[model samples]
Target: MTSFNSKKSLRRVSFISLSFLFISSLFIQGCKTGTKGIESGSNTTLEASINQGRNVFENSCAACHSFERDGIGPNLAGLTRHLSTEEIIDFISNPKKVIDSGNKRAVNLQKKYKSVMPSYSMLGKEKLASLVSFIHTYKDVPKPVDINEEGILEDPIPHQIEKSNFVVNLEFSFQIPASNEELPNTRITKLWGQPNTNEIYVCDINGKLYRVKNNKPEVYMDVQALMPNFKQRSGWATGFGSFAFHPDFENNGLLYTTHTEPIGTKNADYTLPEGLSGQLQWIVQEWKTDNPKGKTFKGSNRELFRIDMATQAHGMQNIDFNPTAQKGDKDYGKLYIGIGDGGAVQMKFPEVANGKHSPWGSILRIDPTGTNSANGMYGIPSDNPFVNITGEKVAKEVYANGFRNPHRFSWTNTGKMISANIGQHNIEAVYVIKPGANHGWPTREGTFGINTQESVRKIYKLTEEEMKDGVTYPTLEYDHDEGNAVCGGFVYTGSNIPSLTGMYIFGDILKGKLYYADESQMEAGRAIDFKEMRIALDGKETTLLEMTNNGHAKLRIGKDANGDIYLFSMNDGKVYQLVSEK
Candidate 1:
């Protein structure tokens, strides 16, 4: 037996010795390409290790062992009071060694159980230590008692849990005429309009922007011609991605568009790093519409910023200015850019010089009008989460991080910024983006564990304390069985649909499954259960199969100047407005 102080010293020494062994295991096991950022135990304290241990226990041991009562194995709640931490760790790591050596207590226990405890030596020393430490922390505390079977909720809204009966109908607005043989590439990816304007600006993934007036679409900008190599590897997910007209578009004629461009001298404002390997770069260009009342762009433009990306798959996807933010507000006139992780699983922390951040896998906020950065092109807001820090782990331009692919984000009139994060495998997440908060990625997908050596989708549970530090969980999440991808929509503030006025309207991209939930619940820091809104056409309830023709309709939720919402299909090229069922 050893004293607590002596064991603490020994634990430190063991942690130091475990580093070389852990790195060697990566080589021996042939490290998975995307799982390189799993937390290493170098700086872990006993408390932190115990948290890791709790995760391991839930994943591997909880099924067989119980803390209160014997399940398939002996009770583990107070095992520390009966056995020393060293003995428990040793026995769990190599039960066979302890039992086969004829150790009297180990042999007697094995005989009584009539089952051999499998050696968990492969859990690695660090994890194993963590697991034991977690178990050791449970001394005499009683297991928590749940009074209600459904569990107590904070500010629970009973109506939100009930299914919604709102019925929506799809009215064919117009198709985004295909420029080529591709079925979906030239279809409308986004439909946007500004206040006091009757015209709607629609853009496609093939580098084309069109102005829709009187249900007719006319070419507004030929983005494909602006880049020579865009057509080489472009599809429905690339090309001229999104566009945003400034809040004061009528006064300044300022507009912005994000496009995928080749990384070399074609547009010479930026260049690829000497050894950078990505073919295309995601860039934002500021354009002055020669005539604000005219139908087409006459080409007065300047480059705002560019990120040389490796893959065009998740390259810069969407951008928008905060519409509700006013003149004296902190967020006024700031453009929010949604950047993906460039088809990679993680991002580079301790951001590099020049404040690109991951530039990938982040939601960036920048002042397009100010010229305070080193490049003197765009300004980093003074209050941005990572604004003034230099040579530190944070990025000056990063507003919030830990996003895999934030396809779309919108602000409500109440100032809640909601983002839909496309998930990797099991689940899709919708988060309320907060400054300096991390919506877990690579490490987590939705509420599930996303990075594990054994499986990418294995669940990793976090403790309450860990969640409060820097990690932020989703406001709503659903498994893959519910929908494939989440299409972010706005919080309904329109008057036409009485039932949906205060509800958030969002849908699935692949299935066209529409859902709405009360925003007040989430705004108050409580998660609300979502209910799928059934779509009815021609006096009959229908599924996506009936509405979309096939099951492949790509659905997008759009908003107009009046804050009225509509749904668009990239597959069939139709737009539908939500109305009261007649």
Candidate 2:
């Protein structure tokens, strides 16, 4: 119930309180041989296998992995130093074999990343060997970075989150078409029902917006087909990030969308000062359709703004309107956009994500129809927190600042804005954001103070002399041991599940596990205790991981006009409706 307040110096595997769940991967190095450099022992390094491996890596592995640094998957640069070619190939084919072995190092790897690297067993031995051969090229692992070796909690929240009294039962309701042929067959992000109608709309990262009728989806808008320069890389939330319909869609038929373009598609409005490399640009576009009720979109598009990022990996996640706002309310029709740091701080360019005006690490509120912004494309609300501030290029559109990745945001019944912020190294947080409040990123994670200069990966106790003031922390938080990423959910207003009414239900995007906090009990400056929500699949006891071929869940939440909730997997393109609560 305390106010917004409050790890170690280690490489990717910091022994801090953050809990990782994915089977610890690459425990391959802590073998009997110790940390000696390893060499591949197979003849599979032929040119063909290497090239095929490269292709497979781009299409499959690239989404969660890389050689230079850590990602959702472990950095592969030094992977060969611990395990031989055969061992790695075997692990990649069926990672669970080693994960299930209960190796201390292996389990810790799971706890560190809190994510499972999908097995490539379907590729068979030939492709698997090729992939390992390709990975073997990066033989030198970078030395671990452990900056401050003091005041770290091995387990952040030592006590287990209690299980809820309600068990949600899911029924298979519908499916979106496949966006790709690999691990995430579908790249759906949001599935929201149209206001005052039975119509439902969903969007995919590969650039398709679908309108569902009678449980069937038809293409509503195709951003990729419409824009030739549109780029969609597998990782880092590039391409068709999210979309929002104007509150007056029935009359205005105006829709807004966020997508990405290649690094140099054009000059960006939010460009880095200098010396920092610009990876890509996250864009916001406004579209107008002549017919709002039509199945196919017939519209014209206009670019609202483009933001340049230092690197990939957290550009834009979601853009939405205040659903609870009525037509005449001041909050009505104002768009809330979630903008991430774009890996700038971790890349050592803290300046890009340093302040509110930069717009890299903040939640922005704008009037889509107004024209008061510097760019003249949108309106900075007259009452935006930073609107009247003078000096140093102020981004007047910023409502609240300090978020690494404000992945999702939804309003509670009381008009409180709850945002789920995906963390770095440790802590996934849910915050009750207020205007101008800084949610401290680069300076803090959850309640722990982190030194960005020394090591972004390590944590230290919050010290007044060592930290800045005015940083707002999360009302609800969990370490990586519980889940890697937070997929936001809404405050259920539907009548189907009376128990869920007034409750905010959400889940882990990586683990497909469910969680919730009663919004009725939420109050100012109070720490909310959330519990794990149990689920049943189609009348049978099951988990989201069990419902998939791979161990990952790639989970996301959605809702119908009636306020009933829906669960869908990004891995398989299937959407499930909440049928009952027991």
Candidate 3:
């Protein structure tokens, strides 16, 4: 039995040797073919080889070694001069063999690095050559700018966009009641800009829309006229809400606004309610522009859509028409709306505690031109994720899901979608949307586990493989401990602020702090590491600027036609431009 075992072992060794030989032959062939693509001129060949080598190094070597800085191993800035390309390739492809063969360099490198450079025997010979080429060309020259300046700014221009600047200088402010007694319950929940009139629209918790122009405030619309008992029935006093103008508002005069409407009334003693009582319902209404060219809207209004709330508190609503979207055109026109999961405060009401309703938490992409159905108010887009899926009663307008209070979202100048989700008690998040991503909200908050029905249903616990299959995760996120509420802002494609260009500007509702996150922070496949962000104010003494008694805080940041940034305060009823204190 011992003799038979020995024979079998010998046969196994022989087979392995033969397999290695075959692979080696294939590797050599791949390398030779790859060399053919290089130019014959020595300089050209060297440069081409170096470029290829850099790609290989970044993908394979840089993870282990840094050319000038320490990574997993020592810097290798001049490694090529110490080892020939052939020797380097052999050592990389079979480090153990070279070390055992008594090659001093390999032996020393292994000992000093304290980690064996793993063999890349499976890599084609061409790839190995490219990698060696990259090593040969590496230099230890200092970068022209401070290495720390890497993501701070990309553009060299110093001026903001010209046309955008014009809008920036057109200043205006809103007037709040001088005495708290006059408007004891007033809360400015949101503010909107009318691109056509260049005027600002403000919505107060008291159910009034005020128009501000030339630093004066006038009533734009009063809810009591439309809904007789708005103050008692509308839950606008509790959450984030917004208004939007149709893309063709200049000509069509159609407007849409989102507010919390009461679902029904209930007896103070009822045990179990039939419909939501004092619950917030997301209502989208349309009103004519009264005077398309005027500062105020005065006309008959119609309700477009009213989504019943799962809970009242966390229901945040934001609306915007795609700036790049063209009207009268079928495929391009769209109204993007964000809905928050019913209030993040768990167990505020018995129904929410029982899990019978869905909290307002999702990004809804809809077409407003079609019939009202589960799919949307408009004809469903053929390209919508669920449009072609068979055997499911899914809503096509649901572009993505699993968001908790997506208070704000915007499309980049290049048309990429980004959003900020207000977390429950633990975290706040920012996500970039791909076609049909599931953001994993109540089930998972900011990439961490949370105990919710969605978590129990296996909706939030996605394995890495499942996440890979679909489900785009957030590009950025932060803990509530850092900032209580996240306010989403725009990407800096504006030309004026050189330092702010390419950065994303965002703020916190409670902290009143402003932040600038670099574009790289928006990259996919990585968790946003926010330690590198630049805060606009030092943490010690600066307080976030609050709006005057208008019950409005600095609610939203706006950009003019020129790309300059402006802060709109709901409490102060004022707009402030971000200019150089210099």
- Runs of candidate 2 with Cα error greater than 4 angstroms are 1-75, 122-139, 144-152, 463-468
Give per-residue CA lDDT, model 1, range 473-579, as digits (tens): 78877654566578888888777777787888888776677888788776422456888887766667775546766434578888877777777766566666665
TM-scores, one per candidate: 0.68, 0.88, 0.59
Roughly what TM-score does model 2 have, to 2 decimal places?
A: 0.88
Stretches of candidate 1 exceeding 4 Å from the true structure: 1-163, 229-236, 264-276, 346-357, 390-393, 452-455, 463-466
Q: After superposition, how far is residue 195 of candidate 3 from its true place, in Å?
A: 3.4
List the lowest-lDDT window of 10 residues for candidate 1.
Answer: 10-19
Candidates, ranked, TM-score: 2, 1, 3
Candidate closest to the true structure, highest TM-score: 2
- Candidate 1 vs candidate 3: which has greater lDDT? 1
Q: After TM-score superposition, what is the CA distance of residue 432 in candidate 3 from its true location, in Å? A: 1.0
Better of 2 and 3 by TM-score: 2
Residue 351 shift from truth in candidate 1, angstroms? 9.3
